[model samples]
Target: MSRLVVVSNRVSLPDEHGSPPPGGMAIALSAALQRRHGLWMGWSGKVKAGEDPSGPISRREARGISYALTDLSQTDLDDYYYGFANRVLWPVFHCRVDLAEYSEARMSGYQRVNRLFAKLLQPLISDDDVIWVHDYHLIPLAKELRNLGCGNKIGFFLHIPWPAADILFTVPHYDDLLRGLSCYDLVGFHTDDDLSNFAECLRRQGLPDPITNGVCQAYGRVFRCGVFPIGIDTAEFERLAEQAARSETLQEPSQRIPGCKVAIGVDRLDYSKGIEKRIVAFDRFLRSNDHRIGKTQLLQITPKSRTEIPAYLAMQKDVAERVGRVDGELGTIDWMPVHYINRSVGPSELAGLYRMARVGLVTPLRDGMNLVAKEYVAAQDPQNPGVLVLSRFAGAARELGGAILVNPYDPEAMARAIEEALDMQLDERIDRWRAMIGRLREYNVYRWCDDFLLGLDQR
Candidate 1:
């Protein structure tokens, strides 16, 4: 069995020994790691310093996979994580061009952390181990690994949108970023547009130019670029939904939205999500069509995210005001145009929510690949599936064409798309669901891992 080493920003703290398993982004990657029960590496989320952070501090086994974690001090958490990674790269990568905060100190800290990660894992890494890294937080990890004279198959996948080269140019150090990415044997993005944007950046940064099929040969290594849109575990999500549908939580809502079609939108409360804009679009949707008052209900589940950031704080206030104003204008005592719910939901309940919805509204201004959109398709009823109103800006839009594509920035357009989805026929809805599911089932997470690994092997 070939060992697979997985790295991420943080590891979930296991509670009881018999828990199902820690399965998030990294754990999903652990399926590939299961053949060898390879090590999963990441920060333990505990603040510390002056200690040997180079070695694994803990270990656990679950679902035929093993996890290892280490602690990072307050300084590292500030500079390496909150300061550099989140405060800078996260906003920039998500296309908030104006909100980027460039700091030389943060950049240096970012580099140090990558080097630390590489140093800690280097000894544990065997020749047969494949290192699969995830997210923007670890972009320079492979470079650090390579710099230490460690040669192994390293593959990277970005879970967030890769901004257009023009937007990326806002950073003072765009060149350095791509230079780090070039170290990976295989680099994966969520869609062709993201790959194009990245490849465009590589060209501008004087990095090795990708040939005909987005292949770039440089540093005595063949870099294979690919667009592998991420997906949820469909069978598992469906099962959870089925179980949730029978729960009292879902039953309460069944009676709550009486005699009206429900449109559902679930997203983290973040600036990039455009939650305020979504509410405004829903307001337009209600104002334009008065008959919809008692006929249509918009269910928005916005769980708070990055609450500590000032920009995010302002966005939350803006969304609240927008939602309130819309309700004040269009909502009657018997019918509220928007049923807004703020806070996180377990996956089990999201499945039920998807089933009850008439439309899955995922219109992020820019998203790498919104898993919610794909999860919605997975939880649909083939006999009478709900419509997916997706943003053209999301990476999933490239593969899930059956979705009712809309530009989220355009309020009027989004409003019309919502109305159209609610009024769609069963056959058309089924056709669209089938097409979307075809792509989803075919290019699932399993296939995504396989494709990325194969590309890495060739390099």
Candidate 2:
């Protein structure tokens, strides 16, 4: 078996045993590296002045996995990361074309950084290694690697939605990006809808469709594509939740209002998360059910991200104003209808919060796969599970069909779904939870990694 070479935009350094991993990519890739003794490589999230683009990569080892990291020059960090990747690709991929920012400098910087990655990474890789690149930031990496004469079986996985051809073409140098994808031996998406959109994009360009068996021919090269929906380590999550449930820190928040049931939403402070819409819907829910104003509270924990970005700054103001409006309209001397926290909470605390809540609200305008939904489900008590009110546009909705699905675009619909979730029967909650848990247990993160690797191997 070939050693797995995992590459992503950010690499999570291995931490202490029994501590929850930082991100889903961290958990999944760490497990793969531990099982196969592979190398993980990525940017070190550092920007240095006058740093050589071809400098030697930094190496570290911890928790049975090896890491190779490189720092970006300040200019590259600005143009490549904050500029093109986040401003352009992130918005376009998530179907937010209105927010997409384009410039020649950013495009050139993106290509330069990818070429730099290829140069630095080439020395560390062997011909027998299986290379797996992750996310929109590194879409052109496989092409750069192939240009350097590394013929390893490379795979690419996009963690966000892949836009239709019409939307994708809106990006500058779109042909180059598509051509870079053709360099990969395999490509993976989170859901069938994403996979279909990708294939349709290719078809629009006169390329062959990705077959059910995951093989396609484009740019005179064979490419394999498949839906590899990511999952969590269910047993591990449950253990964390159990440990959290025992903590007083986790108990105090829910006990803030005696008899009040908590409905929770955890998301990054981003527009695509539908944070504003969620607030509006919660307000509408309160308006219609005046009797439940003090009886129920919507707790939205949205940690700030990319604060330097203009759009994110504006959204922060928007979310704050809306939360204030709702609270002003529905608050009493002793009780507030909504509790909005703009800071991050640790996993253990989050698990505790998840267990304490009576309803889990995951209503993203559009998402690849919102892992919060899965984590929420895993934290629920089997005897009295919390209902999941999910967005139909989320990739997780495809598998989590048992959830109370709603269109996030419509506040009234979302409000109705929240009401339905709140009024759901215990037996129905258990049945829905059991169905979701069955899928979670059957298709754990380990299994997703295995299946993708297996697909790449057979190709």
Among the numbered candidates, top TM-score falls to 2
| TM-score, cand. 1 vs. native | 0.93
Q: Write the per-residue lDDT of candidate 1 for residues 1-459, one digit (tens) a residue.
A: 468888888765445763434233444566677666767889887777564443345677776677777778677777888888888888889878688777898888888888888988888888878888888999999989988887888989899988888888887777778878889888898888888888777666565566448687654556778888777676677677778777886757757757788889999898777677888898888889878877888889998877767788888888888888888887788888888888987787788888889889999988888888999998887788999999998888888999999999999999999999988999999999999888878787777777887777676
Best by lDDT: 2
Residue 69, model 1, lDDT:
78
Clash list (residue pairs), candidate 2: none
Estimate the overall C-alpha local distance difference test score of candidate 2: 0.88
Against the reference, the lDDT scores of all candidates come to 0.81, 0.88
Query: Which pairs, if any, clash in model 1?
Result: none
lDDT of 2 by residue, 365-433 (tens): 999999899999999988999999999999899988779999998999888888888899999999999
Name the lDDT of candidate 1: 0.81
As a whole number from 0 to 100, the lDDT of residue 385 in candidate 2 is 92
